[model samples]
Target: MAPSDYPRAAIVTGADQGIGRATAIALARAGFDVGFTWHDSEAGAANTAAAITALGRRTASSWLDTTDLPSCAPVIEKLAANLGSLGVFVNNVGIGLNSSVVDTSYSDWQRILDTNLNGAFLCLQAAAKLLIAGGSGGRIVVVTSIHAHQPRFGFGAYCASKFGLDGLTKTLAVELSEHGITVNAVAPGEIATHLGPDETRHPHDIPRPGIPLGHAGTADEIAGVINFLASPAASYVTGASWEVDGGMAQMGAQASSHVANNDWRQATRKGTSNGD
Candidate 1:
């Protein structure tokens, strides 16, 4: 098949369910062959591959443990070999840890950081080498979280990892742009997924009543942003974190009110007073 006839190949991580699964399907429908990774979800990954095949696109699934870097390299190498070329890489594998900084154990923090930040770094490096070898421009989209920018009360480890990812994304965009590789990140807030409860009053759930849309966003919504970033339409966009939240991060007042109305402003004033 001609290059035009053959779909571009994309690799999506953590694609068994949620935003990652939706992104794989979206890319396949948009004329991309897909390879996705899932950990301990063979049935779900097979289902995703079946759906992609139904779209008349090629699909591959592999077991991936992001924290296990040595094991990850071979999976990506095999994906590139099978797919003929790797044109897009989506780093969607991540874990959330919610605990106060003092309560967060060293091991837990390391695990979250390893999976969320270090894992993505490895994948990006592998994908970059493959793309460079292919001599074709590539797209790298990272699935970060709104917590990358906004700090949540009890999610210290999660926030740190995501915040680090945001920095990585920006730096990669700058370094890779000369190679025709565009790197970007999407930060979603209060998405209804396995990471958090969808109900209004779950103890572990962050109440999103202050979101301008007044509802939890769907994984598909977040996937839409990833899809756009991977498409030709976003050719000029890079090094940016597109927030998929329903104005959650923009609502500083609401976030501050959870503690005290005046506390936020007072804190801000103190920072300003101290030349911060």
Candidate 2:
């Protein structure tokens, strides 16, 4: 295919590692020239860019702290300009300050909201304007969490931010329909990444009781769903929040008890794997 016939460019934030890196690679494999942002992991981001370039796709990256709202527009503008077109915007940057309502200081709450919710909104706004100006339909995917639907203890601020992001997804979907822009969310449950303590990449060797699927998900799994949404197959789909968790949301509060009891782990002890 000619260059113009090739897939348009895409921007993925927080792509230094984990899900963000996976999504960037996946999009590149799907034929998009990828541009991504990183907060502190310049090396990780460089590796991700190298991987994409190795895939024969153009890639660009810069340091971007999502909480720095003032920088959103310029970053998007520069990336879109460098790539020549903007077709996909993945709002994958977020942080969860583990603290209860009482323990969560005002600064902590604001920090989480600023990065998780406000930053996403600002980036989305800038990307949407670019898409509209291009006069071509685009895709906007936000990476949320299962906590978005079912709250978790000590995650008040995180849950609230995700919930707000979901709401924004729907509202933007409605407004952007006329422009052929589809807005959606991917709510992942427990996905293992470099960010995890063990750095146990997903598809763990052992099952995890916290998730009904018996193990944490892989970043590639979530990236697959995101790639689908960014593809032509999802052209007609909008305003939807896909729970990419392995049935974690369905378990609700029982998730905690199951984790504590360890009874659910007995199945694995019986010499049977969860089959990933």
TM-score per candidate, chains pooled: 0.86, 0.88
User: Model 1, residue 87: displacement in angstroms?
Assistant: 0.5
What is candidate 1's TM-score against the reference?
A: 0.86
Model 1, position 270, has a per-residue lDDT of: 10
Considering summed lDDT, which 10 consecutive residues are worst modelled in model 1? 267-276
| lDDT tens digits, residue span 192-264, model 2 | 6634376555476557765677887889999999999988788888999999989878885676555566443
Give stretches of model 1 more than 4 Å off: 1-7, 195-208, 257-276
Model 2 TM-score (2 dp): 0.88
Provide the clashing-pair count of each candidate structure.
0, 0
Q: Which lDDT tens digits does candidate 1 get at residues 98-196?
A: 567888799988888888888778888888788777766888898898989988766788889899999999999998887788899999887766543
Instruction: Provide the global lDDT of candidate 2 against the true structure.
Output: 0.83
